[model samples]
Target chain A: MKKIKLKVPATVANLVCGFDILGMAVHDPYDEMEFRLLETPEIIIKHIDAFGLPEEPSGNVAGIVLLKIQEYFNLKNGFEVIIRKHIKPGSGLGSSAASAAGAAFGANVLLGNKLSKEEMIYFAMFGEELASGVRHADNIAPCIYGGITLVKSTHPIDIVSLNSPDLFVTAVHPQVEVKTSDARQILKKNITLKSAVEQWGNIAGLVAGIQKNDFPLIGRSLNDVIIEPIRSILIPKFDEIKAKSLQLGALGGGISGSGPSIFMLSEQKETAEKIAEMMKSVYTEIEIESFVYVSKINPSGIQIVEEV
Target chain B: MKKIKLKVPATVANLVCGFDILGMAVHDPYDEMEFRLLETPEIIIKHIDAFGLPEEPSGNVAGIVLLKIQEYFNLKNGFEVIIRKHIKPGSGLGSSAASAAGAAFGANVLLGNKLSKEEMIYFAMFGEELASGVRHADNIAPCIYGGITLVKSTHPIDIVSLNSPDLFVTAVHPQVEVKTSDARQILKKNITLKSAVEQWGNIAGLVAGIQKNDFPLIGRSLNDVIIEPIRSILIPKFDEIKAKSLQLGALGGGISGSGPSIFMLSEQKETAEKIAEMMKSVYTEIEIESFVYVSKINPSGIQIVEEV
Candidate 1:
């Protein structure tokens, strides 16, 4: 059977100070999925890897995404998806989002690109809700739109794609799981107005810096005043990693989405690679197995590898 | 002695959802100041209008600003400034910032533009500290920059000038007083994390909208969920003005700086003029004394109105 092959890139959500609003896509650790159209109206799911994720359409992230796409488009044909997982499911690096966004995008493209990026994001959010307790577009928006995205409002689904500068990203995914719900449960329900103001200032500065292409401004604005102070306790060597990354000339970074993983932004590929080496050295010293990737910000979100 | 003629435009701080961070300049209601260089180091201050402002070198907003500038530059020459006031103090129209920024900028020009915008903003903040019990740069930055500005951090004085779009502004200054200190005192010191997230989303969206030049996106992101709800109560007819202005094709608007004055943005000059007329008619019917002005976004900030 002829199949559609897809490469869906991973993403870093809650970019530094922009909690729940800003996200960016990365080039490495893409999930390669293969899919084929069925003559009969029966959706089939298969896994080509040992990730041991669910194959049931209702329970699987990619499965539920395709089901919704099928229902929305009202297609008589069904999809047979063969998955290969690379991004860990709970690495705080948008694993489930890749699967969900990949499924919706692949289906839409196969159906002659019927839906807009906004529509695809909307449908993919269901799968995200199933993975995490809340329906957030921070990760999904970047995964679908590519580059950096601002989720202005999810209720009305307003997503803005910002201009991506020529910057490199270095990410480390330690083999520790931090369920998004658990990570969210630890946060305080209220913050002091002073802290809130500081956070808003940083986020505003970060957005303006990106638009103006001010590298130093971007670095200065990446400090998180609220979320990181609390969430960093969950990851081992979090403080050391961040301090070392900055000392190694990283612009700034923080917990990618919810938490076991960390990401840093850099102006050059060499700096990004150096940060990766630092991450590996620290993790090795701590006797923890981790995966590190140095790549540029992904300008294109999901790609079609080939149709076989 | 040849005099320096300058026009410093009024600014709208807390531009909708961006309280304490984002600000923009308007062309109308500017304070015109005349400065002449003195032979010895003796700063003389004068106000030509019936604004009942203090003229003492230490107690005056313009006086304190000039003193600091003279001290910083160690200039042997003093400035004799005669100010003509139009923007009213306690009108939520950045009146104090106009004077402060005007003094610093005028002195810098007299000193051959010796200081950068950052240094000028720093000197102007002392005057802001005297007017309101806190040091803030939101108003001073835009007054000096002549466009939209983002005060990223005030401690180190980081300000960024955003690209100003071709938008018209209509301002209504109702003759009532809302002190900056009082306006600040009424706000809650703590805000819900949920509301803060919403606010950050809106601010990020607003900055992106300005950079992308998306009019409708700008309109959509102008909703303020925090400060306006508390401070708007201090302004009479605040809710009505906002509703009617939006109905009149204004993107959105709120209390300009704190209270008593409201500003709305429109795409067309005729719409801005119409908003001005509506404001006048509404204030007239309410038996409230008012002043209205329709102008465009002052992209040049403070102008040298013929440096003699």
Candidate 2:
């Protein structure tokens, strides 16, 4: 094996009532990983971009995942990994997941496609656990499989691929840091039984809405009663952005994953772009700098962009 | 209007993980209510069967609903209601819901059809609250509309009719009682975050499965971690009955509403009958007598058995 280049898409998890359970892939933002075979006895990692990644193999998210994969397969040859960061870190767009998933996927392809896609997802999730302190497959599965993905069960890595039509997603990443640990800590340990029932009902409806391509039903079902109420307080102007996006005929929108960013779904590209502009203007009025990405739903997960 | 007779089918609520939320209608095991237009300005109530129902207008479930409806419309004409109870009470089969919905629906038709279906459901749910001490529309909506029903929001009573295909249902009503209030009291106010996520995933799958008529997916999605674990203990031989029914080719089975009665579902009628026999045998070994009802999915809710 000589060299391999891989592209991994960003993911958004916990779409409304689907707390810690649902996720989907986006197209515009992605991360790139390059793998080179080395004759040296030990593994080495080099960061080519200023994402503030670690230089050593053990500390880096991608490097740690690669070490696990090699140990699992008992590989003797060493490899040098280089990560080129494209998606910004801590934007609630799954930056670390892309890195971990991209590294595992790139290594699998360079090593004669040794592991299956599911196996690669498991390995990438292992890497994500080190970064986030929890082995969640919601972000990693969508980053690997693309489109709208449901994490049915995490332990055995059971994933269900949903049928999503050609839809556009508009995301606005505000330049504010809300740590995942802090965001998670604010959530209440106990929820009202009534709210729990309502959440599950909406989740069921959202799943059916996605499968049927019923946009209105999807919009009606994209509601959160438990997690969003607490987590949205972390994002500035979150309620206003969500209300304005719905008012603009963008179907539904909410805080992406843990926040500092918000996303909305629209049926047309023009509407999606309009939503992006609307979100940008709201953040601008608040005097907060933000970056907007208008992209279509990516059906393809991790793929080889180039080879040497 | 001279006289009319209406029959409303039995309903099963809280389909596993969908506790206090989801419900479905079945074909057999229904309650019959007959209404006669009285020439006088006084309402009369009569219970002709041995289902242990109160005959007084205030204490009777159907008569109380009729009184509320009369108060809402402020009508001078009176009605004579006769309820023929076929579905046994204390069976966790929504038997009370059938009588309440049937009376409301029958009176609505008898009084020149003054209310819409949605309004009728609202009035019927009030009757359910009178019996259960909580205003819930899970059983009333399915009894009124038939098929699988989702009560999206109950404040103004918004109901979403789900598309559920022909499912074979086999139910065993054991000679035991499990109070609705007792079954509800045993549930923990706070659930584990992990179980909550799993429950939502299964609910999403169950919604998709019903929409697509995917039996395998429906079978897999019928798992419940929140309510069933505590409620199932109230029913004797519940675990063995569920296991035997599944082994006999049931897609899934659980306590219909509370306990003492177990229900199983299959794709074919023959398999449903077999599951019913298996469930019966399980209860018979414990010296408990049970009655089995094998029925198909009912699409039409309350129907006129005989018109004026």
Candidate 3:
């Protein structure tokens, strides 16, 4: 196959209690990218969208991952990439992760699938780091592995795929930008042992709840004691949206990544869509244009739209 | 049943990474207790062991739980309690929890089994509070729920029973007193956010590992970044014992609760017994009297030997 077209997914990281570990992939608002293998050792990128993302291979999120692929494989031939991103960059919904993981995944497919899922996640982290200045797999792992993925350790890149219950997600990306680097800068260097204990307990409960398919338990454990209290303030009307959504029967949710985006989980698709409408109304009432998505979690990530 | 004879199993709390949240019950060295209901509202206690634990209703661990039972139920009658504790006090095994949980279990049976398992755990906290200054259900919850348990939140009493795989436990209780309160006091009130994140990641891994009954995953998740480094210093030969145990094909384990007692987990019963023998030899060489136990994970927490 000389050309491969991919539908790379958007993801939600942190999942409330799992600050640097948990994430999930969503079905809507993905990026469309096509990779064409070149006979010569050269690279090129073109953006069909007006997002004004960097086309330079080193400056681009997807381009960085592609560069790593070339060097890691010591390939004499490179690839030309075309990008059209529907998931807005800087929306706090894993836009950069989609690009990064898509680059690695697409290249691997063109290279005859030499990379494992973990290897895809590893190469994807460099792209994630380009976007956030931190090498984190919270988003990349889930994007590559699908379902819910827990990043146990990043140094050697250890990740576990968790069981996904029958659940729906409501995501709202308000037209606001909260830079990931800035979001990370605001947190304190240290947290009280008491808060840490509470956070771990909630994380454990959330993992177990998802494993057992217990909705109430999942709802109860979706608490962010450490990160959300500080990061939520940067997003407009964060508290109102979260609290009212809970009242509207959202299992629970918070700042999707670093946040101009907020996502909530629910048991019913009707409730999830209802929450999405409510989220849209809140942004509309506030005179802010927002993109809303109601999706059951993507079980298989990065679909092959066309391969030739 | 007007009279009940109980065998309350011992427990190991913390389970490495889940400090203050995780625990497991073991089948060996259970305490034998008998409760006899009387016509009048008064509590009596007797000890057949030479441990010389306080016999006063409020001063004793089991007695305190009975005191709460009498008051909570507003009973017209109390009970006579005889105790024989084989799990030594301050051994870092859940000796106090065994006694406390046994009292609540036996009392509930004698009172026509009115209390729920959670209620038994809640009432048992008073007895635990007498042993240490804090009321922790890390041990009590497991002793009541059986198998591996996660105490998500102590307040409002949330306890989750986790699936236990076919794993063996090897325990060594060196004769030294590491008071629970003192061990707790030595820990810093705060931890770095990096360490906290590491801890929660491992905790979530451990929970997921146990739920899936994946043994290697359980072994890797048995790390304790926050508590073990500080608490292990209080136990003799702590580092060597843990290191050698891992080398001997043990999965992983750490200080069972506060210290003086160390536990390791393994896949095979023969490996568990081998680890137990090695532990005994270490203490023997050090000239410290130690008690060793090799057993399977307890499924039924407190057993009813007799009821009349």
Pick the lDDT winner: 3
TM-score of chain B for predicted candidate 3: 0.98
Model 2: per-residue Cα lDDT at residue A178: 92
Question: Candidate 3 regions off by >4 Å?
Answer: none
Cα lDDT tens digits for candidate 1, B252-290: 878898877999999998889989998988889989999
Candidate with more favorable, higher TM-score: 1 or 2: 1
Candidate order by decreasing TM-score:
1, 3, 2
Write down the TM-score of every candidate: 0.98, 0.89, 0.98
Interface CA RMSD, all predictions: 0.7, 1.6, 0.5
lDDT of each residue in A210-251, candidate 1, tens digit only? 888888889999999899998889899999999999999999
> lDDT per residue, candidate 3, A108-185, as tens digits?
999998999989988999998898888999888888888899999988889999987788989999998788888989
Over the stretch B184-280, how does candidate 3's per-residue lDDT look in tens digits?
9999999999999999989999999999998889999999899999999999999989988998999999999998899999999888988898999
Clashing pairs in 2: none
Ranked candidates, highest DockQ first: 3, 1, 2
lDDT, candidate 1, residue A285?
93
lDDT of 2 by residue, B193-217 (tens): 6678778998887877888788888
Global lDDT of each candidate: 0.89, 0.84, 0.92
Candidate 3 positional error at B20, Å: 0.9
Local error of candidate 1 at A295, Å?
A: 0.6
For residues A220-263, what per-residue lDDT tens digits would candidate 2 score against the true structure?
88999888889999999899988888877887868788877889
Give the Cα-based TM-score of candidate 2 against the true structure. 0.89
Q: Of the pair 1 and 2, which is ahead by lDDT?
A: 1
